[model samples]
Each structure stands twice: as structure tokens, then as C-alpha cells.
Target chain A: MIQVKDLKRTYVVGKVEVHALRGVSFEVEKGEFLAIMGPSGSGKSTLLHQLGLLDTPTSGEIRIAGVDVIGLSDHEKTIFRLNQLGYVFQEYAILPELTALENVYLPAMMRGERRVYYLKSGIDILETVGLGERLHHLPRELSGGEQQRVAVARALVNKPKILFADEPCANLDTESSRQILELFKKLNKDLEQTIVMVTHEEWHKEYMDRVIYLKDGLIEKM
Target chain B: MFEKFRVSLFLAYKYLTGGNKGITIFTIFILTLVFLQLVLVSAILGGATNRFNELMIDYQTGNVVIEPEEDTEYISDAHRLMSKINALPEVTGVSARIKGVGKIIYEDRSVGATVIGIDPLDENTVTKVNSAIVDGDFISKLDRGEIVLGREISGGYGALMESKSLGGVKVGDRVNLRIGSVDREFRVKGIYTTLFFLVDSSAYINKKDMEDILGVQDEAHEIAIKLNPGEDEEEFRKKLMGIGINEEIRVWREFAGIVELLTRTITQIGNILNLIGLLIAFVIIFIVIYINTINKRRQIGVQKAIGIGSNVIVASFVLQAIFYASFGMFLGFFAMQYLITPYTVTHPIQLPIGPVILSLSNTEALFRAALLFFATILASFIPAYKVAREDLLKLIWD
Candidate 1:
């Protein structure tokens, strides 16, 4: 479960005050698959980042699983992110120097998981994502869709409570996008994996349990 | 803590080996060249000065010298002092000499030179005068009207002034020596060269002959003493004083004050060279790691986003620097110890003072290597800290 009360974010750009999020508030229950839809510069990604604990809000409170995360120190926040949440960026943020298996197991390594268990769990997740054959391949060697799948596998390796994806299918073709959406649907339905995704595509509604639309930094429709 | 180190090491290894192989090798090569410069530059400088010191000890001044007391032209009871010094357990050899400044004449060519009178057999024991002979034979008791001239003296006053041979006289040529109204003609028995301008411009004669000619019987102007291996010259000088000898006693270092000063100056220069070498290494590593971290900014941001600590990322870059420095220094040490040092020993550089070889001790090598290692770590740390402290949001999105 996640809760946000009047979360606001502001940025200063060359002596100009830019309000990316204007007191937006929302909530999602456990096991829910939510998607935020908005036009360009509508604060969808900014809201997602704030909820995912990737950036601090200007003045607001955020609670995940009933714990207030606003006042956590930087180190405590990193540990919280490691143990409770995972992220899949829009650009398939897999490290280029690492193999698919290495990329998947990096968070596990950071969590101090033993080598044997980390390797086994990494392989299992990659296999579940239909990427067992490409475990040894680098990110550059894989196609965009495959790289996103690897990112998804990496996000799942630590068994975090929630997965945050910001435009996961932005760089994929229609067919590849459908496959990734179907994968997300299966993960949500079968494993009861909670996910919050940001997207501009309208047709992805089939997989999202609830969709919120935003316009100009505020909730316009739900 | 161990787990943190393990993770840092793993990431460092992956980044180092998974990158372009050519760049890795080239970076290591540059590090090797820098380490070599750090080592060889100081060693060469040290070698030249060390060679000068050895020459002074071996050819000019022995381990210790005993001079006549102040206001006395010659030491009284010289034979008694020589016998007592020779009997000391630490004494290896002792040679008493009579020194006098004399004017030399060679068929209209005249010059002033220091004439040192030595007991030929005992002199060879204290100094390598016998070994430095370049022409003819060393003096003997049976040869009375014989003298040995240094190369510069025998070559004439013009040669001595210009430090080049005028070719006026040769070995076996007859020359006249005048010391304080005493004139004597003698045949030059040999011409010796020590490659030292001062030593090569002086002459030598039999001690008994010198005392008789100068009318200073039963006296010596100086006594040179050579000690056995590992004997302390200062302790020996103190021992001579303890035994009630009234003459002034000085060690080789004291007698060769100018050479000692030059040696200290060279050592200071060597320290500057070391500092410059370290600075170069620091700048090189700083720029290299800075560029590398800049190129990997996005990946660093991603790692931070995924909950890898900033300290872990900094540790990885520091580890890479340590690897570069340690490996490069290892190669440099190998070359200096097994290749460069032995080769130079066998084929020394011919300097004006003597032959010079690379002179680096094991302790010195290790100290310099450690210095370079820490310098490189410091170099890498600054940029790594800067990159690690950047905001993850800005790093990823910017």
C-alpha cells in the first residue's frame, strides 16, 4: 500500500520557479496495477518519482506500507529502496559493462545476499522473464525489448514490495510493447506483483487495473 | 565491512576487464613508464654522487687521515706513531707521507706542484696509488734518482691550466724539482692517472728521499689510515685520540667536505625529482579517473538508484587506482632489480670522477613505491568523491 498527502515538487531553473507537482494526492492498495497517463510536462513522471522515493517532495508526506518515509536519512532511504522497491527507467537502465545475469544480481549483491543464492535467484528470475538464453549477453547485444525484459528481471530479483516503471515501453515497437504489457499483466495476476507505471499510450489499459490521468501537474480524471 | 569490500572489488574487476582491452593495457603502460621515471631518475642522480664519494675514499683519502699539529710543518716522532697505529687491531694499513710544495722545471717549462713522499711498499697498502699507474713502474727502494709524475703535471703547466695535454714531457723524462732552495734532478719513472684533477696534477717520491731533500728528518706531514671492513672511522679517530696522539685526526667525510656538500645537494635534487615524479603521477591518475567517472555518470546514477551506496562506488574507483599503481610499480621494481641494476654494474658510465652505476637499495625502492601508491589513491579519491556526491536525479536526467 502507498499513500501521498498533498505531495508537491518544485524546481528552480535559471531564476525561474517551475512547479512540477502542485499539491497532488493519491493512493493505491497492495497488489494493484496502476498506470498514470498524461501529456508531455504534465508531471506524471515527477509524481511517480516522488512516490517511488527516488526524489524528495517539496513539502508533503509519503507513507509506504504504513511507514512514514519522508524523514529517513539518505542511507536509510537507500536501504529502504533496496529492500522494499524496484525501478525500471524509460531507457532500459541496465549497466552496459555487466552481463544480463550481472545486471540482475547487482541489487542482490548490494543487499549482501550470498553468492550462491544470488546467482540462483538471478537465473530463476531471468528464466521467468523468458531471458534465460540471454543471461550471458550484454545490454548492447540485446534488442530494446530484450533489454527491457532484463531490466524487469533485475527489478524482481530482490523481491521488492512494489515496482515503479516510468514509460517502460516508450522505446519499443507496438508488438514488443504488447509483449511487455502482457508480461506485466501475467506478473500482476499470477505473482500478485504490485506495479505503478507511467505511460502516454492509451491501449495499455487492458493490463492496468486502474488508470489516472493528469493535466498540468494536477489530477484531471481517474 | 567485508561484504562491502567484496562488492567494491567485484565491481572494480568487472569494470576494469569488461572495458576495452586496448585502453586498459595502454593505461597500465603509461603507469609503468611513470613509475620507471620515478625510480631511474633518482637512482641515476644518486649513482653519480655515490661514485664521487667512492673515488674520494678509495683514491684520495683513506677512511681516516692524521695531519701534523697546528703551527708544525711536520709531525714529530712520526715512526713511533706509525708503529703504534699499525699495531691497533682495527687498523688495516697505515702509510706515512711527507708533503711539500715544490717548483718543477722541464727545459724552460716551470710549474708549482705538491710533491708527496711515500714509503712505496706501505703506500700501496693504504691507497690505490700503485693500481692507478698508467705508464712505467711504481717506485722501489733500490731506485734513488727516480720520480713518478701525475698525468697533468707531466703534461706541463699549460696542460694543468687547460685540463688538456700539452705533450711537453713523458714517462722516463728527466725533471728538476726545487723545494725551499733545494734543487734536485730526477728521472720520471711513471705517469699515473686517477681521473681526479687534483690528484692527477700532484707528484710522488720516496719518503726517505723526500725527508733527506727537505732536511726534515724523522718526521711526516700526514699519515693515512685504512680500516678493515665495517670498522667505524669516527670510533677509530677517537681511539687514536684516546691513545694520546697529539695530531689532528679526521675521517674521510671530514677531509672531503666539498664532495660531501655536493653529495647532499645531489640528494636534495633527487628529492625534488621524486616530488615532481609524484606530482606527474597524481595528475595523470586524476585526469584519467575523472574522465572515466564522467563517462560512467549515468551508470553510477543507476547504481545509486538501485541502492548501491556512494561509498561503494568511490571505493571501486580507488581500488582501480591502487591496481594501476601496484602493478606498474611491481614491473618497475622487477626491471630495476633484475635488469637495470645488474647491467649498469657490468657497464658503468664513465664519469669524470669514476665509473657510475645505478644505486638503489631495496628499502629505498619500497619506500618510493609506497609513496607513489598513496599519491595515486589520493589522486583518484578527489574525482571519485566529486562524482559520487552528485545528486542521483541530476546525474541520471542531466
Candidate 2:
């Protein structure tokens, strides 16, 4: 579950203030697969970043699972993110020097998990993402779709309560994108995995449990 | 803390082993050259200083010298004192010298010289000057009027101060020596050179001739002593004092003020070179690490976004730098100690002072290694810290 109140973000470019998110408010229930859709510069990704604790909002109050994430220190926020939140970026930002298994188990390693437990968990999650045979492959060695799958597996390895996907299939082919959307649909339906994704594609709405449309830094319709 | 260290080390190991091989080898090779530059200057300076000290002891002051006591012109009963000193088993040689600053004139050319009176056999045991004869032979005890002229005093034979010496005097040539009020003619028996400018400006003659001219029989200005191998000069001085010998005994080092000044100047220059070498090493490491960190900006942001701490990222770079510096130092030290230094020992470099070999002390090697270690840490930290502390958004996207 998430709660955002009066969320606002403004960027200054050479003495001009650009309002990215202005007075936006929203909430998502547990086990819900939500989507934030908007045209360019509509504060869609900005709102997701605020909710994910990846960026500090100019003026906002964000509570994730009843904890005030906006008020936490940077260090505490990092620990919070590690324990309760996961991220899937557009470029499949897995470390190139690390194999799929190493990248997948990074968060659990940071959590100080036992070696055996983290290794097994990493392998199980990679297998779940259909990357069991590619566990030892590096990001450069994997195809675009395979790399995205590896990123997805890494995000779920820590068993975060909420998963945030910011254009996770933006760089993939049409088929790869379909596969990722289907995987998200299956996860939301079967395992009740809570996900908040930002997308520009209209057909993506069919897979989401709910969709919110933002325009000019505000929630135009939900 | 232990967990953080483990993660940091793991990252460093992975990066070094799996990253660009060319960059890694380049860094290590550059550091190796830097380390070698730092230690080589010190080794050469040490070798020169050692050679200077060796020249002083071998050709001039024979390890220990006993001069006349204050308020006395010469040590009385010099032969008796020589016998007493020679009785000690550690005393390998004892030669009493009657010293005088006099002028030598040959064929209208005159030059100041230190004229020393010595018994050829006794002097031979105390110093290697007799064996350094370049032409003719050393003076014999029975040859009263014959003298041994240093190349500097006799001139020619590649003398450094040729213009300031007696013009071109050769063996069997006659030269007039003037001391206080005594003037006499002596044949130049041989020309010797110690390659040390100060010691090579002196002349040696039979002790009987000097005793006759100065009218002080059985008395001498100083008694030079040479000890057996591995003997300590300070301990030997104490031993002489323990034997009731009331004279001004001093080690060779006390008489080496000029050599000390020379070596100290060289050491200061060596220290400056070493500082420059370390600075170059630091700048080189800093630039390389900075470029690498800049290239990894996106990866750094991704790690941070995925919950890897900033300290871990910075520490991993530092560990990598330390590994590079350690390998460089080990290679440099091995090459210097086993290859370079030993090569010089077998085939000494002919320096102006003498045949010099590179001398690297363990303490100096360790001190340079520690300095380079600290430099490596600082060089790696600045760039890594700067990159790691940047905002996640900028690092990831900008």
C-alpha cells in the first residue's frame, strides 16, 4: 500500500522553474498492478520516482506500508529501499562485470544473508524468470530480452513488498515487451505482487488492474 | 563492517580480474617504473656516499688517527706509542706520520703541498697509497733523498688541478721542498694517485729525512691506525683510552667534515627527486582512477539505486589501487635487489670518486614503499569519493 499527499517537484533550468509534478495525490492498495500514463512532461515518471524513494520531492508526504519514507535519512532510505522496494530500470541496469546470478543476489548480499541462502534464492528467482540457463551469463553476453529478464529476477530476489518499473520494456522489441507484460500479468494474478509501472503504450492498460492518467503535473483522470 | 569490507573486496577482485586487461597492465607498469625511479636515486646517492667514505678511510685517514695532545707540537715517544698500539691484536697496522704544509718547487714552478714523513713498510700496512703508484716505484727506507709525489703535486698523468701543481715533475726528477727554515732537494721516486683530490695533493718521504729536517727525533705529528676486518672504530677508540694512551684519538668520520657536506647535499637532491617521483605517481594514479570512475558513473548509480552503499563503491576502488601499488612495489624491489643491484656489484660503475655500486638499504626501501602506499590510497580516494557522492539521478541519467 502507498499514500502520496500534495506531491510536487520543480526543476530550475537557468533561472526558469519547470513544474514536473504539481499538487499530485494518489494511493495504491496492496497486491494491485497499477499503471501511471501520460504524455511527455506530464509528471508520470516523477510521481513514480517520488513513490519509489529514488528521488526527493520538492514538497510531498509519501508513506509506504505506513512508514514515512519522505522523512527518512539518506542512509535509512537506502536500507529501506533494499528491504521493502525493488526497481526495474529501462536500460536493464545490471552490473556488466557481474554474472546474472551475481547481479540478482546483490541486494540479498547487501542484506547480509547467508551465502547458501542468497545463492539458492538467486537461482530460484532466475529460474522463475525463465533465465535458469543464463544464470552465469554477463549482461553484455545476454540478449536485450534476456537482460531485461535478468533485471526482473534481480528486483524480485529481495522479496520487496512493492516493485517499481519505470519504462522497463522501453528498449525491448515488441515480442520481448509482450513477454514482460505477460510476466507482470501472471505475477499480479497468481502471486499478488504489487507493481506500479510507468508506460506510454495504450495497449498496456489491458494487463493492469488499474490505470491513472496524469496531465500537466496533475491527475487528469483515474 | 565486516560485511561491507567483504562486498568491497569482492567487487574489487571482480573488477580487476574481469575488467579491461589493457588498463590494468598499463597502471601496474607505470607504477612499477615510478617505484623504480624513486629507489634508484637513493641507491646511487648511497653508493656515492659509501665510495666517498671508503676513499677517506683507505687513502687518507686510516680508520683511526691519534694526533698530538693539545699544547704539544708533536706526540713524544711516538715509536713507543706505536709499539703499544701495535701490541693490540685488533691493530693490524700502525704508521706514525710527521706532517707539514710546505711548498714544492720544480723548474721555476712552485705549489703548496702536504709533506708527510712515513716508514714505507709501516705506511704500506696502514694505507693502500703505496699500491696506487701510477708510475715508477714507492720510496724505500734507505733512499733518504727520494720521495713519492702524488699525481696532484707532481702534475701530469691526468691530474685534476694540473696548473696548480709542480710543472710536470716525473720520477728521478729533482724537486726542492721548503719546510719552515729547512730547504732540501729530493728525487721524485714515484707518482701516485688516490683519485681523491684532497688526499692526492700530499707527498710522502722517509721518516728519517723529516726527523732530520724538523729536529724532532722519535716524535711525530700523528699516528694512523688500521684495524682488522669487522672492527668498530668507536669501540677501538675506547680500547685505546683503556690502555693508558693519553692522546687525541679520533675515528675517521670526525675528520670527514667535507665529505659529510658533500654527501648531505647529494642526499637533499635525492630527497627532492624522490618527492617529485612520488608526486608523479600520485597524479598518474589519480588520473587513471578518475577516468575509470567517470566511465563507471552509470554503474555506480545503478549500484546505489539497487542499495549498494557509497562507502562500498569507494572502498572497492581503493582496494583496487592498493593491489596495483603492491604489485608494482614488489616487482620494483625484486628487480633492484636481485637484478639491478647485483649487476652493479659484479661490474661496478666507474665514477669520478671511485668504482661505485648501487647500495639500497632495507630501511630506505621500506620507507619509500610506505610513502607510495599512502600516496596510492590518497590518489584513489579523491576521485572515487567525488564520483560516489554524486546525486543518483545525475549519475544515472546525466
Candidate 3:
């Protein structure tokens, strides 16, 4: 579902060049529940962003479902990310002003999808995530676990081929984190989605099918 | 497009009302500035018109002043006095008067004067000088001693140098009127305000009294005619002008350079002020919108990251600016009409304000002001465009 060819990414911070990812290449198949684990400076989130088409690599190319994402225009890349990759950030990117339903429908709206279609798809995603009853509630009104679940619903509403959940449970308490991970695990199994999550929680290992340990930008199969 | 816009609008409305304190506070601030500027413009124009009307009627109306020819002493035929000029469409009414310059001597003091004798009803029917009589009355009772004086003479006697003057005497007093070569006695039944300091030294009575003083039978030294509205006033005067029988016909507007100049300057100043106000309002709106856009850099970045295209995000800001301008203009317009117009109507002389007054009647005044306001809002697009195309990486990292 996702492939990288000697992907290199560099950063310029205060007149100094820092190599984030140097010639890293990897591939992940469809319906795989993969967790990318790494310590600080391991470029875990950066790699995830590159894979999700949120960040462009400096050299080489990233192909998702046979399309090279690096060559896509800004607008095309956005649609690719919207229809193919769904993101669940550590801090829920659920807009505070939006209700749970609006938040879930936001990505689809951003993609300029039909309202009737997105509404139905959004409802289904919310139902699957067990947030169908709380669709009218705002993010602030929802529990942390519920808010994270709404973010998940938003990601999956467009029926993205893959989900990139980057430390989604980092801010949650142990119970909420367990519940969130359980929801993700269940969705991964039931929906057969290709999810590549980036996180460092050792306990989260139990919920995943396999893990890719990233050290110094190199993916080591573990 | 509509659905996306509707969704964005819903989110904006929700945030505006529901604890999105930054945008809410910012909107109110913008509204206040726009309102303040609009009020200032309306007040200036309103006050000037009131003052001009009072000044015009008192100093220069019935505007045609007919003087005698080099050889002819007085206009002999009352029938033909303004007949030729009155034939024009602008001629509303005419009044004839015989004025004789002389010295007015009271018991204790003697002052130089021009004795003006007018037909009481005719004078009133032509010029609105009757409106300025702040004293006893218009020359209703034209007995010998009845006279009107200007505030300038009234000041000489420690009186109120305002609208009215009775020479420190009551309604029924004795005024000694004398012609330059012949002395004439007239009874003062009422006092009127002449409004002009020069005219105040002259006393107004009946033509019968002037005929007695000048000893001229059925004749007047000057003929005054009031022109009607919507008459090509200058052309009308020019057609009847050079035909002045030993005299010339003059339109008040022709020699009214001071009033006209003052009026034009007032209008010009008003236009400039309105433009300046609009410019300031626009700049303020632009800056405010720019700052709001800047503050939302993070939100912009997040939207871009989540597949919200650059064009869509920028279009949203443009839409928001248009929203602000439309709302601001409406609020500003209403505020100016209600709050500022009333004040200006009542207080004509607000110091630095004469210029704006003249613009009140200008045909294009309101339209230009509106145009200026809208133009200012349109100029806000420059700043909005700049904000829309800002570097995404700079926003996310910064």
C-alpha cells in the first residue's frame, strides 16, 4: 500500500543543515497494523508525514497505491492525502468549534465531497467508532477518549486506504489510551485498513500486528 | 463550493458566538472604528447648511440691486420698475426703494446714516430680511419713529450684539431720521435687526417717508428682485442685465464669491475628509484582517496539512474580509445618519467644519462618499492577497 525509494529529507535550522532522513527506503503491504517505534531524533513523525504525503522528501520518491506522491501538485497531494491517508495526531486535530459530526465530516468537506455521501459515510464511521450517539457534542464537551474517537471517525470518513495515527494516545491517561488503542485495533481488524502508527509506548505493542523500530532514520524490522 | 462555504460559515458563526474570543473581540473593535468615522462625516455636512441658510437670507437676497443711471435720479415708473427683469422665469418678486445718505442725530449723539424708505409689504415679499428681524417686529407698523438697527450699532450702546437691536429703547420710541440734504422725521413703532453692520447704520421706513425726505414723487433709487428656483439664474440675469436703465441687474450668485467660494471650499473639504476617513477605515480594516490572518497561521498550517488546499484557505480569508467590509459599511452608514446627522443639523458652527457644510447639497456628495467607502474596502484586497499567499512552512515552524 505504501513504498519509499531511498527517501532523503533535510532541514535548515538557523543556517545549519540537519539531515532528518538519509537515504531511507521501506515498504508496507495493505491491511497491515504497523507501529513505528523510535526514541527522540529518530525522525519517526517526519517519516510518517512523508509516507502520508504531508511532507515531501528531498530525494527519491514515495509511491502510494502506485502513484508517486512527491510529484503531485499541492492540490493533488491534498486530495491524495484526503482519499488515501487519514491522520490522527497526538493532540486531536478535531476543531474545537465543530461538533463531533462536523469534525468527522470536515475532512470530506475539505476534499469537496458530496454532502449526502459524506454525511452517510460520516455516520457509519462514527457508529463504528462507537461515537454515533455523541455526534452532536463538541470536542470540548466530549471525554478525551471520545474526542480521539471522533478524530478517528474524521480520518476514516473519506474511506482512506491507510490511516497514519501519530502518537494519538500520547496525551491520554492509561485507561483512555488503552481504550483508544483497543478501538484502533478493532477498526484495523474489522475494516482491514493499512494503518502505520508512530508511537514509543512499549505497552501499545500488544495491540499491533507487527512493529517497525526506527533508529537513525533506518527502519529495522522487529 | 456552496456547501464548503456554508460549512466554513457555520464554523465561523459558531466560533464567533461560542468562545472564539479573538475573532469576536476583533470584529467588535473594527465595528467601532468604522462607526466613529461615519459619524464624524455626517455631523460636519449637516451643521454647515444650517449656518449658510441663515447667513444668505440676511446678507444677500432679492439679490438684484438696481442703481440709478449716471443722469437719472430715481426710477419713475413703479409699473416698469422690474417689469423687464420679472419677465424672466427666475423672477419671483420685486421690491423698490429710495435710499438717501445722511446723518442721524439723537439728543446726545450723531451718527452718519443712509435713510432707506421701502414699501413695507413689497420688501417683505421679495427678500427674507424679515426673517432676521430679532427685535420688536418686521416693519408691521410704519409710523415715523419705527426703525431697525444691526448688532454693530447695538454694540455701540452696550447692547447685545446679537440678532436684535432697539438702540436701548422699547418698541415705541422716537428715531430721528434725516436725509443728507433734507431732514425727515419718522416715528419708531418697532425695532428690527438689519443683520449687516453697514445696513444697521441705515434706518428702514416706508416709501412715503422717503418720498417726503428725497422729495421725489413715485420713484425709487434701487429695485430689488428675488429669483425663483430652477431658473438658469445667470443667463436670466445676463438677458435682462445690461438693460439696466442707468443701472445694472445683478444676480446674488455673481458677486457672491465669498459665499460661493466658502461653499465650494466647504464641499471640497468635506469630500477630502470623507475620503480620508474612508481611507483610514479601510487601512484599519486591512490591518486588522491582516493581523487576524497572521494569528491564524497555525490554523492555516493545520488546514493545509489536512489537505485543505492553499487556494481554498486563501479564498476563505478573502470571503471573510468581504464579510467584514459589508457589515462595517452598513453599521457605519446607520450610525452616521442617526448619531451624527442630528448633531450637525443643530450645531452649524463646530469650528473646523465650514468646508464640509457646502458639500451637503452637492449632487454627487452622497454617492462619492459611498464610493470612497467601498473603494477603501476594495483596497483591503491587497493585504488579504498577501496574507493568503504566505509561506506555509514559515507558518508551521514559526
Candidate 4:
């Protein structure tokens, strides 16, 4: 579960205040499949980053699983990110040197898991993303769609409480986008994996149980 | 935690062996030079000191020579004075001698040579005079009438042939042994070389012949004594200072002033060599480790962003420096042992330097090397800490 109240994030660009998130509020319960939609400069990704503990909100309170991440120390924040949150960036943020299997098990290894446990779990996560046989393949070797799939497997390998995917389908072809949407829908239903995804397409709303639209840093429920 | 260190070491090994091998190899090169520089300095200092001592062997070692109590050109009771000095526990040997200034005459020429009269058997133990003969022989067949020579004096007098005696006088030809205002004919028997300049052609006769020439039936000119090495020559000199004879005390090391200067000069040269070596090591290690840390900027950023501490990264760099310095040390060591040392055996070369600083023997050497290593590691910090403290999320975006 996650909760954000009246979040406001500002940036100073040459003595000018840029409000990326202004007075935004949101909540997602356990096992909820939420899709966040917004145009450019809409603060949708910024909000997701705050929720994933990747960045802290400048003036707001964020609680994940009833613990206030804002009051936590730097080390505590790192532990929370490692154990509870996972990220899948739009650009396929995978280390180029590591193969898909190594990338998937990175979070688990960061959590201090036994190598044997991570080895088997990495295989299972790849299989869940339909990349069972491409474990050793490098990201550069995989297509745009397959690389995104590896990112998804990496996010889920740690069995995080919530998976945050910002623009997961932004770079894919239409058919590849649909395949990714269907894959998320199936994962949400079968594994009860809570996902907070960001997308720009309107018809892709069917992939999630609820949709939250953001305009100019303000949330508009539809 | 142990796994992390193990992984770091594995990566380090690969880095040293693989694409990043230059830094590691350079470290070995630096250490080797330092080790060899130290060993070379030691060998030079040791050899130089020994050479200086050997030169002193043929020259002077008179400590408390006793002459006549009254003003006299020669001591009349030389045998009795020698017995008195030789009886002391501190005295090891004694020589009775007549210091007669004379002209050595050759065919149509004359040269100044000190005519020193000695009891041949007694003088040998005090001076080890026989050992210095490089040509001809010692004053054997003394009763047959012979004279020894010095290498330099033999050249100066135009002396020729091994068997020819003083002034090319034949075996039976007589030469003058002039003392003060008298001359005696001495048959030429054999020629020999010695450490002193005049010994080459100067005649040696039985000591009684010298007493007959000086016209002193009871004594000789001076009695030279050989004291033990540990006996302080100066202290002995001072002990005999006010005894008020025409005699004086002399140390062998004093007469060989040039040798002492040479020993000091060699030590100074050794010091200079060590400083030069240390400077070279510093410059080489600094550039190499700096480049290595710079190249790893991205990797360092990743580690720090992943919650790794700054201390851990610094520890890794320190480990790298130690690996490099040790490699260089042994390399330099082996170079000295197997290469430079053996070559010096045949041809001794002196390195112009001061006394070696021996930094390795003290912590200053490590302090210097470590300071250079830390400087190299710290040189990386500008880039490492810059990336380390940056926003992790932003880095992921990049």
C-alpha cells in the first residue's frame, strides 16, 4: 500500500521556480493495478519516482506500507528500495555488461540472498516474462520489446511489494506495446502483483483496474 | 561482506592482467628500481672502505717512535729502545731503522732516495713489507747484499731489468751508501719492489753496517712500534707526547688522508643515488594510479549509488597501491641480485652520491611511497566523489 498527500515538488532553473508536482494526492491499496497517464511536463513520472523511493518529494508526506520514507535515513532508504520497491524505466535501464539473467538477479543479490536462491528465482522471473530461454542473452542482443521484457523481469525478481514502471511501452511498436500491455494485465491477475505504470495511450486503459490522469501537476480521476 | 572483497579482488586481478595491465606493470617497474638502488649503494660503500684500508697497509703505522733523549741525529741505543717498546702488552712488533738522507747514483745521473737501514727479519713483522713486492723479490740473500725498489721509483730512475741492482749496478758492482757525510760500497746483489717510493733502488744492508756508517756504536736513528688495531693511536700519541724525546707518534689512517676523503665521498654519493631513486618512483606511481582511478569513474559511481560506502572504495585503491609497490620492490631486488651485483664484481663503479637515506629501513620510505600512493588514490577522488555523491536516480537516467 502507498499514500501521498498534497505533494509539491519545485525545481530552480536559473532563479525560476518550476513546479513539477503541485498539491497532488493519491493512494493505491495492496494488489491494485494502477495506470498513471499524463502528457509531457505533467509530473506523472515525478510522482511515480517519489512513490518508488528513487527521489524524495520536496514538500509532502509519502508512506509505503505504513512507514514514512521521508523520515528514514539514507541507509534506510536504500534498504527500502532494495527490499520493497522495483523500477522499470521506459528506456530499458539495464546495465550493458550484465546479461538478462544477471540483471534480473541484481536486486535479489543486493538483498543478500544466497546465490543458489537467486539463481533459481532469476530463472523463474525470466520465465514469467516469457524470457525463459534468453537468460544469458545480453540486452544489446535483444530487441526493443525483449529488452523491455528483461527490465520487467528485473523489477519483479525481488518480489517487491509494488512494481513502478514509467513509460514501459513508450518506445515499443504498436504490436509490441499491446503485447506488453497484455503481459502486465496477466501478471496483475495471476500473480496479484501490484503495478503502478505510466502510459500516454487512452485505449490502453483496459490493462489496469483503475486510471489516474495528471494535468499540469494536478490529478484528474477518470 | 567477505564475498564483496573476494569479488573486488577478482576484478582487480582481471584489471591488472587484462586491459588495465599497464598500471600494474608500471608498479613492478617502479618498485624494482627502488630495491636495486638500495643494494647498489651498500655494495659500493663496502668495497670503497676495504680499498681504502688496503692502501693504508703499505704506508704508515708508527705510534710512539722512541729516539735519543738528548739532541742527536740518531739514537745510539736503538736495540735497547726497541726492546723496551716491544716489551709493552699493547705493542705487537717493533722495527729498528736508520733514516739516512742520501743520493742514489746511476750511470751519469743521480736522484734523491731515502736510505733506510733495517734488520731485515725484524722489519718484516712490523710493516709486512714483503707483501707489497709486485716485481723482483723481497730482500732475500740479505748477507749477499741486496736492495729493494718501489714501482713508481723504478720508473723514475730509468731502472731496467729484474736482476739489475741499484743504478743498473751489476751483481758485483759496488754503490755508495752515504750517511750525512760518509759513503760505503755495497755490492749489487738483487732488485725488488715495495710499497714505498724509495725502496725500488735504495740499498738495504745489515743494521750493524748502518751503525758503523752513522758512527754510533750503541743506537740507531728511531725505533718504530706496531700497536694493536683497537689501541687508540691518538690516545697512545698523547700518552707519549710529553715524554720529551725527538720521537713522535703517527697513525696509519692519518698519512692516508686521500683514502679517507674517498670513503666520505663514496658515502655522500650513495645518499644522492637513493634520493634520485625515490623521486623516480614517486613520479611513475603518481601518474599511473591517477589514470586508473579516472578510468573507473563510472564504475565508482555505480558502487556509491548502490549504497557502498566511500571508505570501501578508498580501501580498494590502497590495496592496488600495495600490490604495485611490492611488485616493484622484488623486481628491483632481483635486478640487483642477479644483474648489477655480478657485473660490479669485475669492474667496480662508484656512484657519486651522498650517504644513502635508507628510507625503506625506516618508515620514511613507506611514508613516502604511501604518500605518493595516497596522492595517486586521492587524485581520483575529485572524479570519484563527484560521481558518488550525485543523485542516484539522475545517474540511472544518464
Please name the candidate that would achieve the greatest DockQ relative to the true structure: 2
Off by over 4 Å in 3: A113-117, B1-4, B20-30, B54-59, B62-94, B97-117, B134-149, B152-257, B267-297, B314-332, B335-398
lDDT tens string, model 3, A1-222? Answer: 888889888988899988888877878889989999989888888888788877778887788899888999877887787678888887776777678998788778776778797788788889988988998898889998889999888888888889899899998999999988888888888889889999999999999988888788776656
Residue A136 C-alpha lDDT in model 1: 98
**lDDT of each residue in B1-398, candidate 1, tens digit only:** 87778888988888888876776677677777777878886677678767766667777778899998899888888888999999999988888899879887888777788988888877877888778888888788666878888878888533444433325677778989999999999898988877777677788899877988988777888889888989988899899999999899988887677777777887787788889888988998898889889998988988888888899999999998888888889888888878988899999877666788988877778888988999999999999999989999878888
Q: Which whole-number lDDT from 0 to 100 does residue B333 have in model 1?
A: 86
Ranking according to DockQ, highest score first: 2, 1, 3, 4
What value does the interface RMSD of model 3 take? 2.4
For candidate 1 chain B, which ten residues in a row score worst on lDDT? B157-166
Candidate 3 local lDDT, B158-263, one digit each (tens) = 3344323334644445556666667655455544444344344456777777777777786877787776665665676676655654465565555455656666
Say which docking band candidate 2 falls in.
Answer: medium
What's the lDDT for all of these models?
0.86, 0.91, 0.68, 0.66
Across residues B11-35, which tens digit of lDDT does each residue of candidate 4 receive?
A: 3453464444554665677566665
Looking at candidate 2, what TM-score does chain B attain? 0.96
Best by TM-score: 2
lDDT score, candidate 3, position B363? 34
Better of 1 and 3 by lDDT: 1
Which parts of model 4 are misplaced by more than 4 Å? A137-142, A174-183, B1-382
Candidate 2 lDDT, B1-398, residue by residue in tens: 87788889988988998899998999999899988998998899889888988888889889999998999889999999999999999988999999877898898899888899999899988899988899999887788998899989999988899989886898989999999889999999999998888888999999999998888899999999999989999999999999898889999999899988988898899889989989998998899889989999999998888888899999999999999999999999999999999999999989877799999999999999999999999999999999999998889999
Can you give the TM-score per candidate against the true fold? 0.88, 0.95, 0.74, 0.59
Q: Between candidates 3 and 4, which one is better according to lDDT?
A: 3
Off by over 4 Å in 1: B64-93, B101-114, B135-137, B151-188, B226-256
